[model samples]
Target: MAVTVSPSRPHDTITGTPETGSQLTRIALIGNPNSGKTSLFNQLTGLNQKVGNFPGVTVDRKSGFAQLSSTRRAEIVDLPGTYSLYPKSLDEKVITDLLYDRGSAGYPDFVVVTVDASNLRRSLLLFSQLADLELPAILALNMTDVAERHGISIDIQALEQELGVPIVPMNARKGIGVAALKIVMAERLATHPVRFWEPNDELLPLVRQIRYYFNLHNDYLALHYAQQYRSISFLSVDDRQHIAELVAQSGFDATAWQAAETIARYQRINEVLLEAVTVTRTEKREPISNRIDKVLTHRVGGYAIFLGILFLLFQTIFAWAQYPMDLIDQGISALSELIQSSFAGPLVRLLTEGVLAGLGGVLIFIPQIALLFAFLAVLEETGYMARVTFLMDKLMRPFGLSGKSVVPLISGLACAVPAIMGARTIESWKDRMITIFVTPLMSCSARIPVYTVLVALVVPDRAVWGFLNLRGVALMGLYLLGVVAALGSAWVLKTLLKARERSYFIMEFPVYKWPRWKNVGITIWQKVSAFVWQAGKVIVAISILLWVLASYGPGQRQDAAEARVRAAAPAVATAVPDTTASQELERRVASVRLENSYAGLFGRGIEPVIRPLGFDWKIGIALLTSFAAREVFVGTISTIYSVGQDADLGTVQEKLRAEKDADGQLFFTPARAFSLLVFYVFAMQCMSTLAVTYRETKSWKWPLGQLVYMTGLAYVAALVVFQVLK
Candidate 1:
């Protein structure tokens, strides 16, 4: 079979060989999940990059530039990792479109097909599909070290002979074969034809027939597995972009390409595996990986271990961050005091007290937030997160949530914005929408401060389960309750919305390795910094805005507050120091300013509606201030409480506990505390969250629905709790 090559693009410079002439180099890197595809991308692109979402979707598109010695600066698109080109799921279709040139997004000039060496047969099915498409592609055999360690060997020469593509071994984690990978990539880019050429036989004719049958007139043959092979490839393509591409490609083809390839690829891949790899005689010998997975994935016992892990995570987050959190509190408080002392005027005091202190209150959650993200990063890097979804799927599916949703919902335990964003992977719109809607119910880290304060004030620290810490267990229970609520809500949505076929739960159970410390560190650093930066900006801006609103009001309000405070001094305490009177005078001045300000007016305006919820005007004011974040409620209380006192970090909690209503009874009673908890539990209280949610989902619609339903449920539940407890 002789082959002819020609330059497809004007900039292409191919003389005798293939892609050498293709100037606008668009190469896609795709593979099975856990095949080290991302690690390969990191090696190729290093520091040259951009992260953007695909058009009309929230799924991330990470494209970068690679300077190959031979190809020069080539445009590289690191596609979402996918197993096959079939059009069943979005991710798979994204790769399909790139491979076939199906969508509005231009097609790739070539593709780098990544394969996990240990899972050769399954991975190669995708490679074979790429071959059928006749695309200029190179097969990158990733995880060579793991393959060798597991008694797996690959005859690279034979695979190349069979597939007509170069097979390069790579251990991306250690950069062992990266130099070779780049050389192969560069060589293929310069030597292959601008457009792919097939041997021109039954395979090409059959692929064409199917393309015509499916009406996929443009290309994308790899995604149109003949009808018989559809089910297998269907499981492989998870991303929406990939599936859309496959569907578009298949829409043209009338023939079935599915049946032929399933048998053909499996036989060839299996033969290759038999010749190149072997399993050890010591099958009974438990590798470290199996030993851990045994306990972690055990059907009955696994659930218990999962709960135990949740318990430990929250305890560490709440307990460990305390010392650092307290130190930050003290530092910020000292700074505020210094500012007050340096500037003697009322304006200076307002800036220090109302603005800076309020900002400090919001930032105080950072330490705990950082630590929680660190743990999540470790879990993800080590690959335990998949197993979590795997185990959770069984329970979650019964309640209208897909098992894959467990990861995002659990992620919401830290923050809902990213969790909502992460739901983009769900193939079904209904599933994704349900995931976005209910994820907020997963008791996020934002609720920790409120829980800590309440548990300390109401529920005493005690032990239960014999050796288990009871307070920690209670906290875990609250977190689990949120998960339960999420599942329940998702189920209701599932029932309400028209259902689709159950998604293929096809996920790679990657061989566990000791997590890469560098990857872990980078992940933790990025997440922590992003969270802090995002929350910090909003917290600061809102604090400043709130200060201005609370500090100065209109007309007679300021005059009246001053006169009342001044008149009370002589009648109530004649022997009090002039200094005390002056301090009282300042308090009166601050109060008048706040009452006349915008923030105060807003809070007071909503008082009537919130009054039945058992909150005073101060609580109402705090509610308005905390829209920046739920935990802002705590900081708002701290700042507002601080303004009237000489209290510092050490005495803030005590001051809060002793706060009284107009009747002189404790305002934060058991009934009130429980009511507050329920309110936080349900209210669409975090405006910053709503804003982020809107950006991620691209709608006022979903967030609006979320706010209405959650807040309504919260109101009813809290009302019930208050009535019953009181």
Candidate 2:
């Protein structure tokens, strides 16, 4: 067969010429999941990276720049991992789309396919398919260290000749063989000289028509187009229609053809591996992973272990992040004071009370966010996350969710935006929908600020069991409540939403390994950065707007209100000592001015609606402002409290503790605090999450329904808790 190369892309040969200009060579990194693809990508593009969306899709597209050689640099595009070109989920479909559509911006000049050296036959399935496409590609035989430990060995040169591509042995975990792989990538590319599968006479006509119509050279490529034409986004309506007509006329059986092709390809792979690979030790010694799984995966022990880990994780988040959080708070407070001292106008008040207060709230939670993601990353890198999914499958199946739902649900602890987006991995539409609907019920990092502030108000700071901190226990209790709420919500959704599609969970348990600290650090950096930058922008804007609303009124109501308070000050001075009375009078005047302000008026307008939940108008204002983001509640409270008070009044938590009703009762009583906590646990307060839900489900109906149901649940739950306790 003649290799058909695009005339415009003449550098398709094994020893292709490098680009002469500033254009970076594009390399597509493709692999199976857990094939060390992430490690290789990190090694290649240490910090030169940015994530984006695939063209016309919400699936994340992670690409980064790397200097492949002294003179050549490349943009490495990390495509979603898939076993083969046959697409399952939207993520896998991206791989098929990019490779199939040469005009796609993500299409690579060359491909680097990472494969597990120990699982050679299984991993090579995708590489073989790519080779058949005649794309210039190299095989990155990763996990060789693991293979060696397992007494599996391969002749790299022999395998390279058999596959007709360069095979670089890589222990990506140890950063081994990266240099060799870079040299190969920079200097040359290779295509499989031998085709793995040829179209039989029965399907020859269908393949030929597709090839001729699409002007394609490779038979396998033509076959893929014929099979995936309907799913292919680049194919126009006319082209898909033409292919459909051709397919109908040919009477081609796609399923049977796919089965035959897979069998044929694997048969060839078996032959090649037999010649180029060997196992030195075959004594059936159980692996260490199996031994460890015995205890970790046990029905009873596993759950205890999982809960213990969760408890430890939350405790660490509270303990480890406290110092940094306090430092950030103090620094922000100092800055606010400096602004108040430096300027003598409305701008200073806006800077201190609005902008600075909002920023402090966002920054204070960074340490906790970082620690949460770091723990998650460590779990993922060490492969325990897969075990968690496997362990949770039994519990999930009863609720009409599959093992796949566990990942997104667990990920919801970080943020629901990405967690909802992560539901794309669930192939079943019903399960995916259910997962999206319930994921926000999990308390995310955003809830940390709100929870910490509230928990401190109600829960004592002493230990519960002489070792476990009472505050930590309360925090974990809140998280458990969220999880329970999510599962309960899922059960409700299961009953309400009809299931038209079946759900299946097929997951592989990877061998346990030590966490790569670099990857962990990178994950923490990215997640925390996203939180601050994306959420911070909204917080700042809302803070400034809130300042405007709280600083002014419809007309002279605020001034008149403050004047009335001052008019009564003389009597209060006579009742108390002069200095103490003056301070109390100032405080009363500030309160009246805020109550007459626009935000206060709005808060009072809604106070009766939330009164059953034990919320007053100030808390009502916070509830409304925090709809933009849950963490914004603390900032809104801080700004509102700081509006007319001295800079030395105290932190938001202290101010909240000191707040009282006209009846001289503490405002944030335990009943009210826990009620608010429960409200936040169930409420769908995040607008961004709702927007992402709309995008993921491709319908406003689902998101709208989600908002209504969750808000209703929050209201009822909060009301019940407060009524029972009060």
Error of 2 at 670 (Å): 10
Best-fitting candidate, measured by lDDT? 2
Question: How many times do residue backbones clash in model 1?
Answer: 50
Give the Å error, residue 310, model 2: 1.9
Look at candidate 2 and tell me the lDDT of residue 257.
84
| Per-residue accuracy of model 2 over 1-726 as CA lDDT, tens digit each | 111112232223555566677777899999999999989998899877776678876566888998988899999999988889988767788888899877776678889999998899999888888888988887888988888778887877667668777667878877888987887788765454446777888877899889988888777889998898888888899999999999999887789988988999999999999988899987588888898998888999998998899778767876898899889989999998887887789888988988887788667767766776778788888989788878888889988787778767876886786677557657666788899999999999889988988899989999866899999999999999999999998998899897433566777888899999988877777666665666567656766787788788898899988887777768757476588677667766666777788878999999999999999888888877787678767766765564333333236678788888889989899999999999998998876577568766656798899899999999999999999998
Tell me how far the alpha carbon of residue 228 in candidate 1 is from the true structure, in angstroms, after superposition: 15
Query: CA lDDT of 89 in candidate 1?
Result: 60
The list of candidate 2 runs beyond 4 A from truth reads 1-22, 237-241, 400-437, 443-481, 494-503, 571-579, 607-619, 628-678, 685-708, 716-726
lDDT of 2 at 586: 70
TM-score of 2: 0.83
